[model samples]
Target: MQIKDFMIDQSLKELTEHRTVVLPIACYETTINENIHGYIPLHWHDELQFVLVRKGEASFQINEDKITVREGEGLFINSGCLHMAKDKNNNSGCVYICLNVSPSFVLSQELYTTFVNPYIQATNISYLHLVSKEFWANNILDSIMKVNQLIIENQPYFEIDISIHLTLIWKNLIMNGVQLEHEQKEMLKNKRMKQMLNWLHTHYAEKILLDDIARAGGLSRSECCRYFKRILKKTPLNYLTDYRIQKSLLLLQQPESNVTDVAYQVGFNSTSYFIDKFRKSMNMTPLVYKKYKNSHSPFVNNST
Candidate 1:
């Protein structure tokens, strides 16, 4: 089945509105392409996400670190962590199942209170992205596959079973996932920095200054620079540039769009400068990237 493609805002809204009411879930086996070589672009939400790679390999970036997981391996993402997944191998491909669950649905007092509280409390400590080796019995990957099967089959009380298994999975995660005590303290400061990012995302077309972002994050100019570098490994301005590059990619996907139009829409004031940066980050000119995407996609139509 085709998974629904959602914009960032719509995905966030779905996560919030369905927090405790309905379990937000999806499963798909996707064909990977060789030309698409990079992370899926950083994004985040409130729901917990489980990605199980049944076949092939991919690199997953969680927060600041990158982890590689192969077939029979899986990654668990905690709520609100910025992450991206990509297939790095150009010749081979992978198929995976993605599952998203609202934390509140699993943590509610009505069901599995004993197991849920610890998992919820752990979220406050650090984000998790565990890669395990075993794909068979007593392994997180196996459990995730079982849950996916149950979800697809719509078995009786399957949601309950999935929730229960997820609780156990979280328990294992707490045991195995890395402890980030020092990182957690730094992340507290970084959380404020995210406000600047939000503003940039909302107002990319307008001029943004270092002082402006510092004020938004309630930090001194020097402190803001340090904080962003410490967490994201990039300065605020550099992050903004990367964000613009990503936004330009979405615009380029439209067959009618030209490189100049996409550049301006994504906040670049100079078309030549936009082209330069796009080429640097994407390794192709905007038009070239657009043509490559169109040629690779089977669904694209040449005729309007």
Candidate 2:
């Protein structure tokens, strides 16, 4: 569950250089298990992701919200939004297809006039979380399934056909509940939030207090709390806890580090405390995480 590094310049270059004549959208369907848990721990990419739950249920953590998507439902995670998905069901695991497309692939003048402009104008929500129980969600899911089939089938103009269906899905999403004023205000607030988050990412392993983040954002503690709640829907400390756990994940990946060392490195004082937090946040103990990592790959024994 290592978070993928986001090289902004490289990503933008990739997006811009990618030819539109035949957009190369990566598609994949994978299974989840104890070894290959199918947990994509919190990460962000520049590409928009469309995931359809063909079987089993998935709990998706998008920013601060935890959403459960069951079979017959699908999710559209917009670009730059932190998200992760995992199966919480015990009996049967989940299977899903993921389609990732660079925004530039569909950001043509025509698409702009039709969907992009409207989306930009309507909702400041960086990621669109679609809850599909109704026919609308089903229709979009059906189209996405077909797109995957076509891509796998390697039929002619498959990319174009997928794009067309994707556009329709976008239109339906906009029509459902997206609004302009709310979108604008939310976007402005999110900009400030991102600045705050960047600062935390650079300094989380160090001693950082709520006041420090508040001052960095040019807001008082109370104001910062309200602003954070508005955008991220979580308190500062909660966000910090999740962030710390995420950082610890990388440390856990290393064979040289023990659970206690990982805890102290991530700023937790007590090993017991770290274990408690890691269990609560990740639903697995630190040792289990290490074992999971080792089971999936070649183990290099590094004892401290």
Candidate 3:
């Protein structure tokens, strides 16, 4: 979902919403997929997010891949990637630790130009799963643990320790050749995809077609669908429908809005059709979703 409304931006991200300027890093512990929804809603961020499953099983949607990471495992989401995290079954609470790191805080100019810059300039690797026994994965996880420890202890020069750990993590990834996809063609594709997503997000509440979206991205109709299919594993219309449902969630927050009105405002023509799609996506009716959100009130779920 890429509404980018009041809470999150158009790319469905909360960029610096939870990040600090001085340290440019944050450690978050959260339990998600409990008491309410089955999954964390799809959203992205402007920083690389490292998720470690402390208890229970977790699933992550990184671009086209559906990664199921069990306990003790971790995954690294590239910056500005469209991803979602949630409990696998929604029966048990998925507890996890998330470390958000901004590369600028730790990477030197040389490292950035050679490693981090190339990684950021292109868009092939959506996420790299840190598995046990794997060479680079093991090294990355070790660095993640060190960073977690330093942040939690906050001893003298703890920030410096965290920075060192962060550097180690990137170094491990770069050494494993994760930055080799930074070619000219991928850079152009990434830029065009972002532009297409922006156009779709801005016009989601209006009557728009695939051809219009293709034109906005400067691509042919078939190529436009192919681009989204390759990266997101979904059709253009499917993404648009999901995004409309996401926008409707925010609309349902208003006490005065009814289901039909909310559906119409979010660009759905038929009320019953909207209800069906919303129920299928969110596992509840629009009215019920509104009530649930109100009950949760001021505290935003930090599972993602």
Candidate 4:
């Protein structure tokens, strides 16, 4: 549940620069089990991202759509899309390679205007699942894997090689054509949802009410409930409680922290209520979970 070194502004825009000014691309091999929560929390950035499942299947929530990418398959997420990923099968956590490339890294102005800008700004195309059944999609998957490998190995001229692969992937996307009618309502819902989630993340440690959340999103209580149900499949208060519990996990692992103190710090008015919710969500009491995390080598891979 902890995003290592991950920072987001009040707008819920991720502050991490996955791609640099000089390189404009970066890749990483991520394992779902390594993340304490077995999922990457919802966040977005300006980079167009490609995720290729290397070992297991991953279920992704992009905006309000759920897409599952299996082994050897991939997914393309457009820039500025709200997305998160988790293991589809919890028994074996998903292992995937991610490539984040700047949308503006085009070869020329012509390419940028013709292929990149429109695709990145396409409100209807939040994400596209890539399966091996489609030949072009398979190629894109191969390119994504190759780019990850090239970056990992740091081979000579790997930057050039990676760029070539990315260009090919971009061409495949444009030539194949992904088109859908825009849904302005859904887009606005996504914006309002982000606003509310941002407020929750910022104020989870403070006492909150349903009306407060609604006001933060500039919506009525009913509309706020509907939005949360539509996007997160949970009530506003439920999501807030879940978030508080997630925040408490890291605190619970701290050496000086105790269950009662941690409970109050995370905005739980009653320690018993916190313990009950913790037990239900984690299958253990907060004290037991704390002791276990303390006894074992802590889960240090924080980049959820």
Task: Compare the candidates by lDDT and give the number of the best one.
Answer: 4
User: Which candidate would rank higher by TM-score, 3 or 4?
Assistant: 4
Write model 1 residue lDDT over 149-204, tens digit each, in one string: 77678777887887787766666665664443334555565467557667667877
TM-score of each: 0.78, 0.72, 0.83, 0.90
The C-alpha local distance difference test score for the whole of candidate 3 amounts to 0.76
List the pairs of residues colliding in candidate 2: 122-179, 123-183, 124-183
**Could you give candidate 2's per-residue lDDT for residues 71-124 as a string of tens digits?**
877787776666767785854667777777666665566666766654533344
TM-score of 2: 0.72
Question: Candidate 3, clashing residue pairs?
Answer: 4-9, 4-10
lDDT, each prediction: 0.67, 0.67, 0.76, 0.82
Off by over 4 Å in 1: 1-5, 10-22, 29-38, 107-114, 121-138, 155-157, 174-187, 294-304
Relative to the true structure, candidate 4 reaches a TM of: 0.90
RMSD of 1: 4.2
Judged by whole-model lDDT over C-alpha atoms, candidate 1 comes out at 0.67
Clashes of 2: 3
Off by over 4 Å in 4: 1-12, 20-22, 106-110, 180-183, 298-304
The Cα error of candidate 4 at residue 273, in Å, is 0.8
Ranking by lDDT: 4, 3, 2, 1
lDDT string, candidate 4, 1-304, tens digits: 1123355665568787676335887687788766776477677988898888888888899887898888989999998888878888875668888888888774556679866777777787888888878888888998987887777677778888888998999887776666755677766777788889888888998999999999988999999998888778889999889888988988998989999999999999999999999999888999999888887744544355
